[model samples]
Target: MSSRKAEPREYHGAAGGFGSLQGIARIELKERAGPGAAETLYRQNKPEGHMCTSCAWAKPPNPHLAEFCENGAKATLWDLTSERCTPEWISRHTVTELRERSGYELEMRGRLTEPMRYDAGTDRYVRASWDEAFAAIGAELHRLDPKSVTFYASGKAALEPSYLYAVFARAYGHNNLPDSSNMCHETTSVGLKKVVGSPVGTCTLQDLDHCDAIFYLGQNPGTNSPRLLRPLMQAAKRGCKIITFNPLREKGLLEFIDPQDPVAMLTQKPTKMSHMYMQVKPGGDIAALMGVIKRVLEIDDEAKEKGLARTLDDAFLAEHTHGFDALRHTVENTGWDAIEANSGIARADLERAGDVYAGAKNVIGIYGMGLTQHVHGSQAIGMLVNLLLLNGNIGRQGAGCTPIRGHSNVQGQRTVGITEKTKLAPVEKYRELLDLETPEEDGHTTVEFLEALLDGSNKGFIGLGGNLAQAVPDHERVHRAWGEMELTVHIATKLNKTHLMPGKSSWILPCLVRAEEDMQASGRQTVTMEDSFSHIYGSIGKRKPASEQLKSETAIVAGLAKATLAHRETRNPKLAWDEWTGDYARIRDLIAHTFPDEFHDMNGRMNQPGGFYRGNGAHDRIWKTDSGKAEFTDPTVLNACGIGEADGRFHLVTVRSNDQFNTTVYGHSDRLRGLEGTRMMVMINPDDMERHGLADGDLVTLIGDAEDDMERTVRGLKVTPYRLPDGCLAGYFPELNPLVPLWYHDKLSKTPASKGIPVRIVKE
Candidate 1:
C-alpha cells in the first residue's frame, strides 16, 4: 500500500519481469480484493468482461494469459478494493483537513459509498439524497444562462454514459461538453483530421504484427502504457526495427522481459526493444520529424539519380496525396544546423534513422503526448503524417499512424460526442437527430472553461468524472477559479482534490466504476468502450458494486437530466429519462441513430466475442477532404518550441510516474525510474546539474518564464540527475503544473502546452 522510504537509485533491470509481478502483488495485497482479484485479473481484456481501466491499447483477437499490464491490474484492484469512504467518515473531516492530504493519501481513503453534500456550518460533507442534490443543481442552472455552464467528462466512463452525458447537456441547451481529450490529444484529432480525413488511428494491433519497422516518437510506453510494450517487444524479437525518439530512455522501449513469456521470465534474459534510440530534445518533435523526412527525400533523390529502385512511394503519393512540392520546399529550406540545434540530434544520426525508414517497406509511426502537448502540437502531428505518407505507409496492412491514448476510453468519449466543438459532423448529427436545443456558438474548452470561471463568465460546472483541479495546468489558478463557481457536481468512484475545492454549492455522488456490477431494471447492464484503434468491446463488471448506494453513470446522468430539464423546453418534446437509464441499450440505439456511419450495428456488435472495429475512411484510402486527397501540410512556420526565452533556461516537461495514471496518484513509487518516497523531484541531465552547481538530492526551485507578470514557482524540488538532453528537465505532473501558464497552449486545439515549459532552476 505504501512505497519504500528509501533514497532514489538507478534501476538497471529490464522492465516488466519480476518487477511487474512484484507491483501487481503489492496492489493485490493492499486492496484486499479477495477472490475477486483473481477473477478480475482473468476478466480483464476479455471480450465478455470489463475492459481494463488503464491505457487505451487495443486488445488482440486471441490474447495472452495476461493481457493486462501491471498498471491495469493495479487499476482493477484499486477499484475493487474493500475499503469505502462512507458518509460518516467524510463527515468527520473538514474540507480544509481533507485538502491538506496528499493525492495519494486521498486515493488510499477508498471509494465513496454514498452521495454527499458540503455543509458550510460544519465545513464537512454530509449524506444527501440524490433528489436533493439533483434538485439543487437544477435550480442553480435554471437561474443562470445555459452557456455559462460547462459539462466535463473523463475518459473513465464508457460509451453509453458518455452518450447520455452529451444528450443531457444538449437538452440543457449548451454544447459546452469538454472531456479529457481537450488537455491531451485534441491536437491528434485536429491534426489527423486535417491531414488524413480521420481523427482516430488508422492502424490496429495487427498492423504492428506485420509492420517491417516502427518509428515510435515522443512517448514513454513503459510507464504510460505497459501493455504496449508487448507488441514492441514482439516486434523487436521478430527482427523488426523499432526506432524511438524520446528525451528520456524509457525502460520498456530500451529492453523488456515480458512477464507472460515463460522462457524470458525464467531465464531473466531481456529482449532489446529499440533498435535505434534518439534522445530528442523537449519540444523538438517537429524538427526531428522534419529532419527525418528531409533525409528520406534526399535518399529518394539519390536513388533516382543512381537509377535504382525508387526510395519513395511515388505512385501512391501522386495518386493519394497533394502538396508534395510545398513539403519539399519547407524541408529543403530547413538547414541541418537548425535541425540539429533544435532537435538535439546530429545530422549523421538523423541520416541513419532516415536510412532505416527509407529502406523499410512498411513503417508504422506511433506517438503520444510528447508530440501533442506543444504550441504547434497539431503541426507536429502533421509532420509525422508526412513521414508515413512519404513511404505510402498509410492505408495499408502494416503501416499507419497510431496515437497512444492515455485513458481507457478517452477516444471513445469523443467518439460518442463529448467535445466542445459544435461543428463536428457527428456532434451536429447528434443534435439534429435528437432534436435538442443546443447553443449555436462553439462552447469552451477545458482551459476556456477555467478562464470563464476566473473571469466570472461561467457559474455552473457538471463533471462526469476527473480531477479537473489537479489534472490541468495552473493548479492554483484552477483551484481559485473553482471556488468561485455557483454550482459544481462530480460523479466519481472516490474522493479527490477537486471534490475538496468545492464551489458555493457542491455535491459529490458515488458511481460504479468499470470493475463493478450495475444491475439496472432491464438486467445486469454492459457498457462498451472504444480503444485507440477504434475497436469496440463489451465490458460487464465481474465484481459487485462497492456500495449499495452507488449508481451507474448512466443512472446518475439521467437523474440529473430529469431534474434539470423539468422546466426547460427543448426541441425534443418527449424525453423518457427513466426508460433510457433502465436499459443502456436504448442509449446505444440513439447513438446509432445519431451517428449511423460508425455505430450502425453497435448494439448488435456487442454480442460478438471480440467485438467489431469502427471503420476508418483513411485506412481504406477514402479521402474525405475538400480536395478528395490527403493533405501534405507545410511545416515551415510550425517549428518554434513556444519557449519565452530559451537562453539559460531548461525546457521542463511534465511526466507521470509508473505508480500513477494521469491525476490519480496510486503511490509515491516510480519503480521504472528508480524513484520512491516522493514525486517532487526533477530529472535533469548530469551536465546540466553540474552547470547549475547542484548535486543529487539537492532541493531546488523552478521558476516559470511565463513572462505574464504572474509569479510561478515550484520550490524545494529534489534535483535528480538523469540522461536527458542538456537543457531539458522532467518532473512528475500536477506537482509541476503550476509552472505552466493557462495562456500557453496549442492555438489550433487549445491543448495546454504542458511540455517544453521554459524555466530556471535555482538550488535552495
Candidate 2:
C-alpha cells in the first residue's frame, strides 16, 4: 500500500490493552485465516505452538489467553499470510522492477512458494528444484576458500537451526558467522562479558517481582519490546519507581495498559510507568549514569556520617567485587558542572534519581540500542554494571541489568554459536562431533564482512535469514559491495530487498517460517528458542505449509551442506546429517553433546514447567570474570554540545516508528508519534527548529559531520517538530541508516554508532 497523507491522530491513553486488541483484530482481518488465526495467536508462546517471532521478551510460566502484543500480531500475520510469490510472479517482473517496492510491501506480498535461481539472460528468477539449487551452490562453494564465505544468521532463526548453521559453517572450515546481534547487541555482549563474564543480561524476569526501581537508559520498550510493558505496569502499580533516560519521550515507558487485564480495558485508566523521565541528549547516557553515581557516592558518604546504614553495599562489594575504593574516589572527584554539561541532565535531577536508586533495596537497569549503539558503548555498559554493583543490585531476587533485545531469537542464536569475533563454545568439542578441525582465525563481523566483500577477500554469502543490505548502515555502500560478491544465497520465506540485489549468480531458497508445520522424514518436528532472559524452550508450528515446495531451515541447510561437504575431503557419512535433519531431537543431542551444562538432556528438560534457564554466574554472587571479581570501570562520557564548538550540526539518533520492528515496517502509521502515513520525515525539538529558523514541516537535508570532515549525508527529510531534547533529531532506521557512517563504530564491539550521529541540518 502506498502511503497516504495526514491521518495524524493522538493516542491519549496507556499503550497496549485496547490498542493491542485493535491491532490483532486488524491484522486478523487482513490475513483472513479465520478462527484458526485466533487459535494461532493464542497458541503463540504456549505449549504445542510457536514462540513469538517479533521480540525476545522473556515469557512467563503461563501465557495469557492473548499471549501476544500488537507487533507480535504483525510478525505472525506477516509470516503466516495466505499469499504466495510463485515463479510465475517472478517471471512477470524483472529484478529492477521488483526492487522499487518498500521492504514492508515486499514482505506483505506474502511467503515465497518455491525454489528459484536468478537468470542473467531474463533478469528474472526461474523455477529450480531443491537439488539443482543445492548442486549449483555447492559447486561454486567448493572452488572458494572457506574464508571467502560468510554465513549471516537472522534473529528469526530458532536455536536448533542456529546451532546447526554454526556447526556446519565451522565444520566446513570457516568461522565467518556474522549475525543480527552483531548489528544490535554486540556492544552488550562485549561489555557484559568484560564486566560480568557473561555475554547475556545478568537478571531474570522473576527479578521484576521484587524490583523497587527500574531505570531505562536509552531504551524504549514501547515499540521494541511491547510485552515488557506488562511487567513495567505491574511494577508501577506496586509502587515501583520507573526512571527513564531517553532522548525522546517513549509512550510505553511513560504509561502502559495490561491488555490481558480486563479491569484495565474497562476502566481505561493508564498506569504511569516513569516516575522521572529525563530527556538525555544523544550520546549523553553514559555521562548521565556517571552523574547519578557521583551523587550516589555523596549520598553514601552522608549516610555513613549520620550513623545510618550506608547506601553502598560495602559487604557485597568487599566480597564479590574489586576496585570499589578507586572507583568511589574517582566519582567523588567528578565535578557536577562537567557532569551536567556532558550528560544534559541537571545536577538536581541527577541527585534526585541517585537518591531513589540508593534508597531502593533492589534496582533493575534496562537499556537497548541507545546505550549500545555509541562510540563508547562498551564503556557505557560497564558503567551500567558499575552502577548496579554500587548497591549490589545484581545477584538478587529483583535486581540486575537488562538489554531489550528485538527479534524473537537474536540472543538465542548468539547463545547457540552464531558469532564472528571468537568461538562461543570450545572448538575441541565441535571438532570431535563434526569430525573436522574448526578454523583458527577470527571471522568477519557484519561491517568487516562488507569490507571483505568490497576488497574481493570474500566472494560468497549465505544469509540464513535477514535483510543484510537494508538493515546495515551506509546502505548505498553495502548494496555496491553486494554486487561484487561471487554468489549470494538467501534462505527466506519472503521477498526482501537483499534477495533482489543478488550476486553474480544467486539463489532464493524458499523455506518454512516458524508458524508453519515442518514435517521432516522422521516425523513432526519441534524447534527450540531462547528468550531475552535466556529461558530456553520448544516451539512447534500448527498450521499447514503455504506451499509444499517450501523446506524447513534445517532441511535446506542440511541438504545444501550435505551436497557441499560431499565434495570435500572433510565429509564424513558417519556424522549422520540425514538423521539430524529428519528428527531435530538429534540436533538437540548434538548441541547437548557440546554445551552439557546448559542443554544436557535438552529434550527432557524443555518439557519442564517453563523450560530451562541458562544460569548466569554473576547473578549468584559468583564472578567468572578474568580477574575473578567485578571490576569497576571509569564512566567518562563526552557530550555533543561540549564536543562541538558552536557548530550548526545537530545530534541525530536514529529510531524506529511504532509500526516498525527492526527493519520490518508493519505500516506507514506511527500513532504513538502522531504520524499518519509517511516515513519521509525527521523528528526534531521545537526549540532546535526555532534556533535554525525552521518551521514544523520544513524540508531539510542532513549531513553526517565526523571529526575529520568525512562526508555522509541523507537528504530530503521533512522536519516533524517533536518533544525532544534540544540539539537532538530523531529519524527512522534503514532510511536514516544511510546517514550512519560505516567507519563510525564502537571500537570494542564494532557496532555502528547508529544512535549518536553528528548531523548538520540545512534547508533544501
Writing each residue's lDDT as its tens digit, candidate 1 over 1-764 gives: 11322233567898999999998888888878777688778878987778998999987778788779989998888888888889988898999999999888888889999899888788899999888888988788888788999999988899998888887887787889888999999989888999999988999888988988899988888888999988888888888898899988889889999998899999999999998899998877788888898899998999999998877888999999999899999899989998988888998888898999998988999999998998888888999999999979999999999999999999999888787877763656654766555667787889899889889999898888889889888877777878788888999988998999888889999999888888989999999998899989989985878888899998999899888888665435546789988998988888888878888978899746556887899999998777889899898543536764467788888999889889988888888888888998999876677776777888999998876788889998998878888888999998999999988898788899988788889888
RMSD of 1: 3.0
TM-score of 2: 0.97
Among the numbered candidates, top lDDT falls to 1
Question: Estimated TM-score per prediction?
Answer: 0.97, 0.97
Mind giving the per-residue lDDT tens digits that candidate 2 earns over 1-764? Answer: 11232222345766786776776667667766544777788888877778888988876887677778888877888788777888898779999898998898888887899999999888888899998999999888888788999999988888888888887788777889989888989998889888888888988988988999998888777777888888888999899998899888888888787877788789987889999999998878777888889888888889999999999988888888887777777777878887887778898999899988988999999999888888888888888898999988888899988888887899888877888756565687766776666788889899898788767899999999888889887777778778678899999988989999988889999998888898988889999988878888789997898898999998888888888888876557656778889899988888888788888889887755466897878788777788899878865554422235246877788888877778777778776666767888888876677777777677999887766555677788997878877778888888988777777788687898888887889888
Q: Against the unseen true structure, what C-alpha lDDT does each candidate score?
A: 0.86, 0.82
C-alpha lDDT of candidate 1 relative to the true structure: 0.86
Range of the 10 consecutive residues with the lowest summed lDDT in candidate 1: 1-10
